[model samples]
Target: MRLILRNDLRKLMFALLLLAASFGHAGATPPPKEDQIILALIQRVEARTDLVFVRNGSDHNATEAAKHLRSKYKYFKVELIDAEDFIERCGSRSELTRKPYQVRTAGGAVRDAGDFLREELRALRAN
Candidate 1:
């Protein structure tokens, strides 16, 4: 009878531990809501461009910039907290090329990626 009681107590303790762990997990914060949206915006920017971007003071096409951003996402050094952070750290410049990115729009207007994305981010926030 004592052995059975001990076993039951052990099982009860295990169940309590599991319950506590589950509660802890439930209380943890979820990932930011803007990660996927920012990625899609990058793709949109890539698709909309028809001219060259100045990367490290040289011209690069939209495809190249998009590819570079994708690669950065693959091996991110830290967690991306939001869309703005992702744009500032990943999409606005090229770490590998050590340069700020500038896009030349289809109409031949050159704009810095940071400025362009800030406007885009504002639009997104509004909607």
Candidate 2:
């Protein structure tokens, strides 16, 4: 009986080890940076935008995200524009877009949803 119990315990331990190994890859949590959040939001545009950033100024959260993503993912094209530049291009506006991105949802605007966030980064991030 003792031998049987020991075997059962070993099996349980082995199962636990396998479970832990599977979960190990998920152990590393990403940092809570603004750029990371922006990237996460822009996740919707992944198929279209390898890296499309619509932020104002030389320094901003999107820039920071681009820098970080550059370190991690090499196969991306980072594009940056002034917040105003995006609003001019798109008429509709979200709080993120001080200019406006609130135009009729169609065609090129729909195609460039990732570019829609340029104003969002400005309102949300510094520089």
Candidate 3:
């Protein structure tokens, strides 16, 4: 009877191990590569305090721009297949007014936000 009980205990342990392994695989998966790139681009925006983000007709600081981009990313995540798609869809222009987004450097130079982010993305990929 003791030997039979030991065998049962081993079987139970094996079953538990299998259950744990299955759960590990079923747990939350990491974001896709493009999503990671998009997130990195947003981080870059947040880090660059020397730049001003212009959307529509208003200027925003880096933090505000990053926040807005995050909101847009969540809204357009399903449609984005790559970092470029994210730049074009969420970072490039105002959906409401069709106005292109702009970025102003500390030196007072202005450029399209999409182009800026594309350059950043290229740098990230190179690294």
Candidate 4:
């Protein structure tokens, strides 16, 4: 009877180990490379105080632009998988306001948010 009990314990331990191993792979997969690039671009865009973005037919500073994008992202109804989706649905324009956001760079150059982000992504992909 003791030997049988020991055998049952070993089987239980082995089952537990298998269960743990299965759970390890169940966690979310890492975000794609483009997502990382997009996040970095968002951070950089957020940090720049000089850049201006037009939203809702009004001008917003860099911080406000970042905040707006983050808000859009959070309240977004759909699952955002990549930077393209975020840029299209949130960063590029206001769905409610119907205004496309434009970014004014530090050098006094103005660009559409989508174009600017695509440019940034291109540069990053090049490296």
Candidate 5:
């Protein structure tokens, strides 16, 4: 009888530990607002296949642009304060060539990448 009770007590303790762990995970903090905005911007870039991203005098597809932007975001994350900062630092220009990035629409209209992203950001905020 004592052995049976000991085993039951051990099981109860294990159950309690699992419950506590689950509660701890539930209370974990989420990413900052800036990070959320930056991720949204990246997603926007990835979804827009109609626009050509111009970096260093070459054009890239949306997938390539999104990948490049993600790498730049990771590299410059520590220095970034907000979504605008991220656009300016990571999405705006080529770090090596010092040339501003551009976006060409399907109709051959060109605009600065920074301006495009800023407009997207504003649209996101509006919604």
Candidate 6:
């Protein structure tokens, strides 16, 4: 290999820096949520919930996913509200903020999804 002169090395380094900067944000997007085939995903989640026992899903965050599961189970209720809406009502600093569907049920009855479902669904349905 031939030695690069000081000036040549400087230029090469600058060129490399430019190239690196140009590709800096190539993979920076937040990532697309599979909106197109959301229906398919909902169906699959529903099937999974049915095959197994207990509650499975969220409330405000995963409305679409939850609704699909509910439809499949006929007893589960999936209510999706805007994260901002939850924050606005409950306050932004709340841990549940931005979660939208954090899977909250009544009286800590999450383990008992089928039992007291009416009470839990009503609570989850709350804004």
Q: Give the TM-score of candidate 4.
A: 0.62
lDDT of 6 at 16: 99
Give model 3's TM-score versus the native structure. 0.75
- lDDT (C-alpha, whole model) for all candidates: 0.72, 0.39, 0.89, 0.72, 0.89, 0.36
Q: lDDT winner between 3 and 6, please give it.
A: 3
Off by over 4 Å in 6: 1-4, 28-62, 65-127
TM-score: the better of candidates 2 and 3: 3
Candidate 1: which stretches are off by over 4 Å?
1-32
lDDT per residue for candidate 3 within 23-120, as digits (tens), equals 75243322587688889989999999999999988999999999999999888777666788788889999999999999999989999999999999
Candidate 6 per-residue C-alpha lDDT over 27-67 given as tens digits, one digit per residue, 9 for 90 to 100? 33212332222333343334433232222343433444345
Judged by whole-model lDDT over C-alpha atoms, candidate 3 comes out at 0.89
Q: Judge candidate 3 at residue 99 and give its lDDT.
A: 97
How many Å off is the CA of 73 in candidate 5? 0.4
List TM-scores for all candidates, in order: 0.63, 0.27, 0.75, 0.62, 0.75, 0.23
Q: Which digits, one per residue and each the tens of the lDDT, describe model 4 over residues 1-127? A: 9999999999999999999978752433326675576667677678778778877668888788777776776665245656766677777777877677888767778788888877766766678
Q: Return the TM-score for candidate 5, rounded to 2 decimals.
A: 0.75
Error of 4 at 93 (Å): 1.1
Instruction: List candidate 5 stretches off by more than 4 Å.
Output: 1-31
lDDT tens digits, residues 4-118, model 5?
Answer: 9999999999999999977752433224977898898899999999999999999999999999999998887777778888898888988998899999999999999999999
**lDDT of residue 39 for candidate 3:** 94
lDDT of 6: 0.36
Candidate 1, 1-127: lDDT as tens digits: 9999999999999999998977753333225557666777667667756767677787777787777777776555254656776777776887777578888877788888878777877777777
